[model samples]
Target: MSTRTAELLASIALIVFSLGLMWTVHTDGLKIGWVPERGPGSGVWPFWLSLGMALTSLWTLVRWFRRTTPESRNEAPYIESDRFGLVAISFIALTAMIFLVAIVGTYISIALFLGFYMRFVGKHSWPMTSATVLGAVISIYFLFEWQLSKYLPKGLPMFEDGFLWLDNFRWEYFM
Candidate 1:
């Protein structure tokens, strides 16, 4: 598909996905409370996110019709043959990452992604790359585990028992 067409469709899809998220959250008894005293309920975030996505999609549709931007002009081919291989490789890497997550878990997969991109694609020093990866994994672990009080996926059999035990402390702030 042409870049313009792809963008239009993708934005529309995002809007639809956001709407579904908002609707599901609402239907699942999550109230979109706005009062300061009551605080923002779970549905508020998804509802606002859906509204933003819908507005962006509408803007994209308008741009597609007006052809105001250079990309919307649609003069050039969508995917040049030379860049096709790079696109394919990127998708392959993403699929590999998904499998990695299934095997290792989310934090490890993210660290691997950062390491791969930083070392191979970005051509950074090993020390810098390793530090960045470590930082990212640590931050994510603390964010979900401590701040959000949520347990991320830990697929390895060795870690499963540990994670199940950790799950009990999720609401206790993981301290």
Candidate 2:
């Protein structure tokens, strides 16, 4: 609960992360050697960078054990209970948004995300959230699909789908 505990936990996490990075670099064929005629291989930079991170985290771990720093002297709690809930909610929302994007199109996913964020987090009224979502969807549809003629991910067989080649539809042709 104290700052010292938080620092130690973070250091441990960093150590684990650095180990994973080292494993990835090794698996990816990190070649630290430079060719005679050419420059270093792709893995050279990553190999050294990961090595540095690993060493730094190890140092941090040592520092935590020593508790010699001013930050360690202060025993303030790292994360308050109230703020943790907000962080958890935001993270869950992001995961749900990804799932929604895969099931629905990007347009609908963004609209839903904005609606949730506005109504719940921002404490906006339903009408304001709805209008904002609608306006955003329309802007995205026009800017990316209509004007730029780009193909974005579409969901469903009907209205929920984006990038419907509606850009190709000419008013003159209809006339």
In order, candidate lDDTs are 0.78, 0.79
**Model 1: which ten-residue window has the lowest total lDDT?**
166-175
Question: Model 1 lDDT vs. the true structure?
Answer: 0.78
Instruction: State which candidate has the highest TM-score.
Output: 2
TM-score of each: 0.50, 0.76
- Tens-digit lDDT track of model 2 for 1-175: 8788878888889888988987888887766779668799777887778789989988978877787766566687676777888888888998988887767877878888989999999899999999999999999877887688676676666744324445435333542
1-175: candidate 1 lDDT, tens digit per residue: 7877766677678778867877888789887777667888877887777778878777877877788756777746579878887787777777887888878878778888888878887799999999999998888878877788676788798757766676677646644
Model 1 steric clash pairs: none
Of candidate 2, the 10-residue stretch with the lowest lDDT total is 159-168
Alpha-carbon deviation at 63 in model 1, angstroms: 1.9
The TM-score between candidate 2 and the true structure equals 0.76
User: TM-score of predicted model 1?
Assistant: 0.50
Please state the error at residue 83 of candidate 2 in Å.
2.3
Clashing pairs in 2: none
